[model samples]
Target: MSRIEKFCAAFPDGDAERIEEMLHGYLWDSISVRDTAVRKNMKEKFYHGMVLGLLQSRSDWLVRSNAETGEGYSDILVYMPDKTGIVIELKYADDGNLQ
Candidate 1:
């Protein structure tokens, strides 16, 4: 199945583990030999654009970028037809330290 199919399967029930698994697949699959910046100094914007673009490819879910959530702006916001929402926050790690 495609990313959207996997994501749709994981969307309901609000299972964070499955959603994160989808994120992992996306993050890894997105890397390519043409994109060497990731190994050098890729910024968070790259991730944001790629993810946002992917989310926007499908019309079944509502997708937004830099969405305002009363408290602050989210990196990406996705809402299902049933009104379920997923807030995605992208983080960049430096010097191989994820913490």
Candidate 2:
């Protein structure tokens, strides 16, 4: 089974709360270290690297960054055979208006 499949088997309903909790627990120190190093200039690449690092153990999933799609490029793409894929678009909050 794929990593996502195992996750779904455990959570069954895409549990955002549990996922967030797990990520926060795993990434808190890494993010803090990155924050201390970069201070005010934290970029999307940092977060992307952290995510990639965290998910590196999921060998069944194909993870890519800055992949070109048809019309544009995707920041991150997580693919699993015969299952749902994940596309992430990374954006810096200070660069554009999110409202």
Candidate 3:
């Protein structure tokens, strides 16, 4: 198994692809993140991926999950690279209380 695959196995509830997407976000965000070490690592990998065309500056992708699992709202939300806005609305409202 790939190194990422092995790491992801520990997060059985997480999709490997989703983790990649989050990593992509972490690598590409315009603002600097707090940790220098992690930033350096991700930046190197991201640049390599970009050089090889594995990732692009603007790509349409979304990380979403809706199921009985405790994943909750989108862990990462990505807009289409085309800059089109997609709307999500609730047909019903939830009470402030959680069981």
lDDT winner: 1
Residue 1's lDDT within candidate 3 is: 66
lDDT per residue for candidate 1 within 1-99, as digits (tens), equals: 886767656655667688778866877877875654665446677877876876676688888899889989998888888888888888777674768
- Candidate 1 has which clashing residue pairs, if any? none
What are the lDDT figures for the candidates, one per model?
0.75, 0.62, 0.37
Clashing pairs in model 2?
none
Backbone clash pairs in model 1 (N, Cα, C under 3 Å; residues 3+ apart or in different chains), count: 0
Q: Tens-digit lDDT track for model 2 on 2-89?
A: 5434443332245656655655565654456636356445666676676666555567768788899999999778777658687766
lDDT of 3 by residue, 11-55 (tens): 334465664565556456633554334543354443433322322
Quick one: RMSD of model 3?
14.1
Model 2 misplaced regions, further than 4 Å:
1-14, 31-36, 39-42, 91-99
**Alpha-carbon TM-score of each model against the true structure:** 0.67, 0.62, 0.21
Q: Between candidates 1 and 2, which one is better according to lDDT?
A: 1
Alpha-carbon shift of residue 74 in model 3 (angstroms) = 29
Number of the candidate with higher lDDT, 1 or 3 = 1
What's the distance in Å from true for residue 40, model 2? 4.9
CA RMSD of all predictions? 3.3, 4.8, 14.1
